[model samples]
Target: MKNLFHSYFESFKGLRKEIWLLSLITLINRAGTMVIPFLSLYLTKNRGFSLEEVGWILTFFGLGSVTGSWLGGKLTDKIGHYRTMVISLLLSSVFFILLQFPSSFWAICLGIYLVMTVADIFRPAVFVAISAYSKPENRTRSITLIRLAINLGFSAGPAIGGLIIATAGYSGLFWVDGITCFLAGILLLKLLHPKRAKTEMEDTFIQAKSAMSDKPYLLFILAMVLFGFIFIQYFSTMPLYYSEYHKLNEMQIGLLLGLNGLLIFLFEMPLIKFLESRRHTATGYLILGTFLTGISFLAINLSDWAGILVVGMLLVTIGEMIGFPFSNSFALNRSDGKKRGSYMALYSISFSISHIFGHNSGMQLINRFGYEFTWYLMLGFALLACLLLFILKKILLRENV
Candidate 1:
C-alpha cells in the first residue's frame, strides 16, 4: 500500500518548473470559471430568456470561440505564446466584466460572443506554452498535470459559484470571473519570464508545415468535434435536465458538476501514468473513453432515482480522465516543432465547433422532444465518434508501417 501511494506521487516527478507555473496560471483562471457553467440557468431564471434564445446565444459564444482560437494561433506564431497568453488573459478579463451589462437578447448574445472570443484565445496559446516547456518523454504527464489543475479549479469553481449566485445574484459571477482572470495575468507576468520560454522554444524550432494540409490530423479533429459535442452537454443542457427532471436545486447542480471535476482531479494523473507506462496506442484509450461517455448518457435514463445522476456523472468523469490528456499529447505530437501553435489551434477549434452546434442543438432537442430523447441522441453521437476514432487509428497505423 505504501509503495502504491509512492508510485502515485512519483507520476508527477521530473516535470519542468515552467509547466508547474503554467498550471498555476490555469488554475487561477479556471477557478473563477463560475460564469460559463451557469450561463444557461442565468439566462432562463434571471434574464427570462427562452431556451431557444439561450441556444442562439450559446451558438454565438461558439462562433466567438472559433474566432478566438484561430486568432490566438496566428498571434502565438507571430508574437510568441507569452505575449499571446498575456494579452488574452488581460483582455478577456475586461470582456467578462462588460458581459453583465447586456440586458436584451441580442445584446446578451453579442456580449457572450465578445467575451468568449477574447477568453478562448487563451487555449491555443497555453497549449503552445505546454509544448515549449515540457520534455518529450513526459509530455503526456505534463498535459495530465495541467488538466489536473483545470479540474481542481473546476471542482472549486462551481461549488463557490453556486453560493455566489444564491447570495449575490448572477451578476456576482461576472465580477469574480473577471477579477480572477486579471489576477492570473498578473501572476503569469510575475512568475514566468518570457526570455527563458523563448530560449527554450528556440532550441527546438523546425521548419513548420501548415496544419490544414494534414488530412489525418483533420480527420482526428472531426472525431474530437463529435466527442466534444457530446461531452459539452454536461455543462450546457444537462444542468437543465437536473433541474427539470431530477428537481435538483442550483446548489445541488453545482455540487454534482463539482463532483465531475473533483473525481478527475483526484484520479486522472495516476490513471494517465498507468496507461502511459503500458505504451498502448492513444486511439485505444480514446475508443474506450468515448464508449464510456456514451454509456454515461444512457445511464441517465436508466432509473428515476436521483442517485442515477451521480452514476452518470461518474461515467462522464471517467471518460474525460481517460480521453482528454492523451488527446492533448497526440495533437501535440502530430505537430511540427514551430507551427505547433497552428496545430493546437485547430485542435482547440474542433471543440469550439462542437460548441457551435452542440449546445443549441441539445437545447432545441430538449425543447422539442424532452431530456430523455436528448440523452439517447448524445449516446448515438458518442458511438459515431468512437467509429471515426477507430478508423483514424487504422489509418495512422498504416502510415507508420
Candidate 2:
C-alpha cells in the first residue's frame, strides 16, 4: 500500500509549477459550477418553462459556446493566451450574474447565450496556456491533472449546489457561480501575472497549416463531436431520468451525479499515468474509451434496480478518464505552436456543436421513444464514434509510414 501510494504521487512529479497554478485556477473556477448542472430543472420547475423551451435555450447556449471558442482562439493568436483567459473570466463573471434576472423565454434564451459566449472563451485560451506551460513528454499528465481538478470541483459543486437549492433557491446558485468566477479571475491575475507566466508566441520559422485545412484532424474532430454528443446526455437527460424514472429527489440525484465526478477525481490521474507509460496511440485509447462509454449505456439497461445507475455512472466515468486527456493531447500534439489556438478552438467547437444538438435531441427522443430508446440511441452514437476513431488510427499510421 505504501509503494502504491508512492507511485501515484510520483505521477505528479516533473510537471512545471505553472501547470499546477493553471490547474489551481481551473479548480477555483470549476468549483462553483453550480448553475449549469441545475439549469434545466430550474427552467422547468422555477421559471415554469416548457421542456421544449428549455431545449431551445440549451441550443442557444451551444451557439454561444461555439462563438466563444472561435473568438477565444482568434484572440489568443492575436493578443496571446494570458490576456484572452483573464478577459474571458472577468467578463463572464458579470454575465453569469445577469443571467439570473431573465424570466421570460426569449429573455432567458438570450441571457444563457450571452453568458455562455463569455464563459466558453476561457476554453481555447486555457488549452493554449497548457501547451505553453507543459513539456512535450509530460503534457498528457498535465492535462490529466487539470481534468482531475475539474472533476474534483464538479464532485463538490453538484452536492453543494443541491443543498443551496434546497435551502436558498436556484437564484443563490448564480451568485455563488459568479463570485467564484470573479475570484478565479483575480487569483489568475495575481498568481500567474503576465510578467511571471510564459506567454506563447507564434513560431515564425515553422509554417503552420490552418486547422480548417487539416483533413485528418477534421475527421478526428467529427468523431469527438459524436463522442461528446453521447456523453452530454448524462448531464441533460440523466438528471430527469433519476428524478422521474428512479424516483430520486434533488439531493439524491445530485449525489448520484456527483458520484461520476468523485470517481473521476479519485481514479483518473492514476489511470492516465499508467496509460501514459504505455506506448499506445491516442486513437487506440479513444476507440477503447468510446466502446466502454457505449457499454455504459447498455449497463443501465441490464437491471431496473436503482443500483444499476451507480454501475452505469462508474463505467462512463472510467471511459471519460481514458478518453478526454488523450483527446486533448492528440489535438495539441498535432498542432504547431503558431496555430495551436486554432486547433484547440476547432476541438472545443466540436464539443460545442454536440451541446447544441445533444440536449435537445435527447429530450425529444425521450419524449417520443422513452428513456430506454434514448439510451440505445446514445449507445449507437458511441459505436459510431469508435468506428470513426478506428479509421482515423489507420489513416494516421499510413501517413506516418
Best by TM-score: 2
Per-residue alpha-carbon lDDT of candidate 1 for residues 1-401, written as tens digits (9 for 90 to 100): 99888977888899999999999999989988679879989999989999878878888888999999999888777777888899999998899988999899999988998888898889998988888889988888999988888877876788899999899888888999999999999999999988965763453355457688888888889989999999999988999999988899999998998788677766788898889889898889999999999999999898999999999999999899988988888898888554777888999999888878887789789999998898999999999999999999999999999
What TM-score would candidate 1 get against the native? Answer: 0.88
Top candidate, metric lDDT: 1
Q: Indicate the residue-level lDDT of 240 in model 2.
A: 95
lDDT of 1: 0.87
Q: Worst lDDT window (10 residues) for model 1?
A: 199-208
Query: Candidate 1: where is the Cα deviation over 4 Å?
Result: 1-4, 38-52, 102-105, 161-173, 199-206, 239-256, 299-310, 367-373
lDDT of 2 by residue, 1-401 (tens): 99888887887899999899999999989877678879989999999998778878888888999999999888877777888899998997888888889878899889988888888889998988888888999888999998888877876788889998899888888888989999999988988768432346545124456688899999999999999999998888999998999999999997887788777766788888889889899999999988888899999977889999988888888899898999999998988644777888999999999988887889889999999988998899899999999999999999999
